[model samples]
Target: MGTATKAILTVLLAFLIFGAAYASSGLSIKSELKAVTIKYSLEGTPYIDYVGLQLPEIEDQISGISQDTTKILLSRFYATGLLYNASKANENGYFTWSGELKMRVRVGQMTTDVNVPTTINLYGEYDADGFLRSGRGNLTTCIITISLYPPYTIGLSNPINYSFDLNSQTVNLGEITQLTGIVSLFATTTALIVALTKDKDLTLISET
Candidate 1:
């Protein structure tokens, strides 16, 4: 092979080996859900409340066996309305109420690292006085959905899905909280490694 051709081949081989090494490893999504918050309020019903908010899922960790391979990852938290029930109490009109919940998960590495925007899916019932029976009613529960590596990307075949219910009062909030913490922990650990490996021309996590 010509000198220039040989050089190109060598670089190509190095990249292939690097890519294989990186794919075998994985990144971690820390659980830092402590940043999420939920609040509610109501009108004349005195029994209802309004609540809404969206939280972002940050990085946790990136792992690699070789110095040339790194993985691009995306992740987020979400909530979906599974079911709800409400009843009327000492009032002339019946009351209708339903709830929704949030869940969290990480989207593994992708060929493209573009951030995916989060979406909220809502499905529930509202029962209040006729004055405002239907007017952008407050969301009793918010179903959160997120995608990774957007704009023409579909390899994993299945995106993460989380269903949450907040009306029961004994719902599984821990699952989401735990996942968030894990993602956060991973991000912090990876950051520390990067800070320490700065002296070397090599990156601690490879993006091969």
Candidate 2:
């Protein structure tokens, strides 16, 4: 055989081996909850509060042996409504509140930012003679959905979902001081791999 022909065949063999290695391996992912904040209005004045919680740190790996996805859910409480006059029975009140979930993702060497907004709806009823009625208030909940895509992978899109119940039973103003401790935890882990073979060098391969 000619020297050039033998050289070409050897190069092709090497690429096949490398490609097989990549095909056997796969992708990985990691995630964590960074922070949570709540804001509300009471008597025409706005109030903001931050929940005290420990955050998890994350790192990415090149090896294919890692979790495929990570998800976190952060919940906060907001004051929906307040009784202006306790003397009037059967009075109704309404208030608006909001919170947020912030996330950071690391895909290989690239990091992306994601923010999800949350809102709360609250309603309350008063009793006769302006006294606030027990079990007359209601609170609304929130949910978040996140979808992640790799750089060059095919037939693979990771989706993460979270739900939060911010009802009156779940949150309260006087008890807020006690709820300041860490209540929940979240985490995500991931790994990445880029296939590079001499035979495939002529054709550009995207990074994931």
Candidate 3:
């Protein structure tokens, strides 16, 4: 082979290898609601209907534990309700309205189901309107961070054990960054209450 031809082949081979490693450019995650349930307060013709996790920021903050650049998926926690308490239905029939959250990361490539934990729970609840309301949880995948300190380390971190209180606004939940992947699926309902609620109180509580 000619010298120029050999040189070109070498460059091409290098490019191919590099592409395979970072070809993903950025991270793209696909998800969908696995199990879903809905309950009415008054009777028929629902006034409020919602589902999915809550306090997205909290879950992001916890699961965001990374070593370097956070290109790796660690552990993840998911819940069926977030806007409020996720109570248990008087009965377990079957329902699937479905829900999910899509995210674009700066850079990452890895299988999420590897060497990590994924958790999902739904406590369910009854809203102030006498209807059920407990949609308790935060969502997302991912982390642990360490701080530099001496032996004088003070006892800190999520004070309780097991998990956060899934029934309250201050409840705990894996919690992510640059982080615009705030998934709040409880924003809409068959009654369109989310639109009005978002302006009056929902947004305010979420921001806090």
Candidate 4:
């Protein structure tokens, strides 16, 4: 092979190696509605929902943890009943709704196995008409703040805990609240490669 050809091949080889090492352009999140259901009573029916876990931002904030960038997810807590709780066919059921917050932080290729703090707060209210309404259809209305701190050890059963300070304005949970976070596609890829590399007998060669 010619020297020029070898040089070109070397460059290609470097990129290939880098590509293998660099898996994510940003972080990513895996989320699910851990639990959700609707309850019925003579007065009214209440809805209950739960978000399993919030993910990290996959775009925008690709860099490590930053205050300017945030990774947060808001959840709504729901319930309903009338002033007089009743199960009879003629009475209406009183209902109430609330919300809780959970946070997940991602650093580099590792989604630091940390205990995320979550709290359920009253987020819904009933009107004179007996209609259930939330501050917003979803908690997306609130400006969420995300702060990534250094990785720390968390027990298998212990997770970070955070509670929302209830206010008159925060209640009613008829609908689902969106959970948002900072996840990196790049970071994910990095993690996969590291794991695979550990078990592989790797080989490298320049491309022409």
Candidate 5:
């Protein structure tokens, strides 16, 4: 093996078998998650309507799966804040209301409550006895659908419906049920799955 040291050990054994076949599979989501446009104000609320709902677990903003492989991944990040053009809610300046949309699923610790049927796309300004003196919303329900439930060996990256968009930047809204600004989350792809745990008493889901 002296032919230039056998071509440097055959290119270091093909870079360690292409880094272990790209860490054993696919998936490489990305997103520092940024998108701000928060400007809400409500004075003397007597219930003029102002509700929000968004489930953002995202497996910790995702990154090559961990946290026990997202419990078995076969998800449905539920989306319900209505505004995909419902006649723009009665074509006016802007006015729409109707809330409530919660999702909780954990089939290993007794916890499964999924309620879907929501609508709320607040506009802005409304005084003279109708709480919500000011309003502005943009962070509907987190929409996502994941799949990869087997003996652990995924290689997906063919449009699994992974969308990511939300980047405005205009913060100056005084909270309306804990608004921290920014939105939209993502989890990349292109070979990246370094989690190993098929079944050794697999049970890790109950983090609602």
Candidate 6:
């Protein structure tokens, strides 16, 4: 083949390899509600008190490769019951609250609906003078399992997991820049090899 034709072919081959690597190195995510439990107790004489559970807003970050840009995946936070035991208080009694939080989880470019289970336990006490004695309030328990799906195999590495308290506002899993860089390097290397081979072939043909 002519020198120009050979150069064009080499460039095309490199781009094709790069495109394939880019497409195959995508990332995905999956999340599930593991468990939740809340317990509370009241001390001293019978008295009325209310308990409520509040979860922080959930968000995931999507970082851009070429540009300094970031995209946030905001989850629609919905809880089955936020307020519990409004009318009467369990006098010197312990209580346990459990329920589910429904949210839309986003993995890469795809989004899926998932239900996260939650539970909380608390204890409270009052003094003889009708004042608060010794007790714990605003207690919460939430366990969520986050699964990360990388385009490449993780091998022995464990998937990302997050555990948050009721007071927690945000939990950032991590970023996927390392994998993107690796794929880019592979594409560039493959393109260089193709160009080098073409150069060798052209030199041999001219000598013959």
Highest TM-score: give the candidate number: 6
Clashes of each: 28, 16, 31, 47, 7, 14
| TM-scores for every candidate against the unseen true structure | 0.20, 0.20, 0.19, 0.20, 0.25, 0.26
TM-score-superior candidate, 2 or 4: 2
- What are the lDDT figures for the candidates, one per model? 0.30, 0.33, 0.30, 0.30, 0.30, 0.36
- Which ten residues in a row are the worst by lDDT in model 1? 65-74
Q: How far is candidate 2 from the true structure (C-alpha RMSD, Å)?
A: 23.3
- Is candidate 1 or 6 superior in TM-score? 6
Candidate that scores best on lDDT: 6
Q: Report the lDDT of model 1 for residue 180.
A: 55
- Candidate 1: tens digits of C-alpha lDDT, residues 59-162: 23212212111111111212121121123111232223333222233355433333233333333332321111112223322223345445533322223222
Q: What is the C-alpha RMSD of each candidate to the true structure, in Å?
A: 21.4, 23.3, 23.8, 18.9, 21.7, 19.1
Worst 10 residues of 5 by lDDT: 182-191
TM-score order, best first, reads 6, 5, 2, 1, 4, 3
Ten contiguous residues minimizing lDDT sum, candidate 4: 173-182
Candidate 1 segments exceeding 4 Å error: 1-47, 50-169, 202-208
Instruction: Give the runs in model 5 whose Cα sits over 4 Å from its true position.
Output: 4-6, 13-78, 81-97, 114-119, 123-135, 138-208
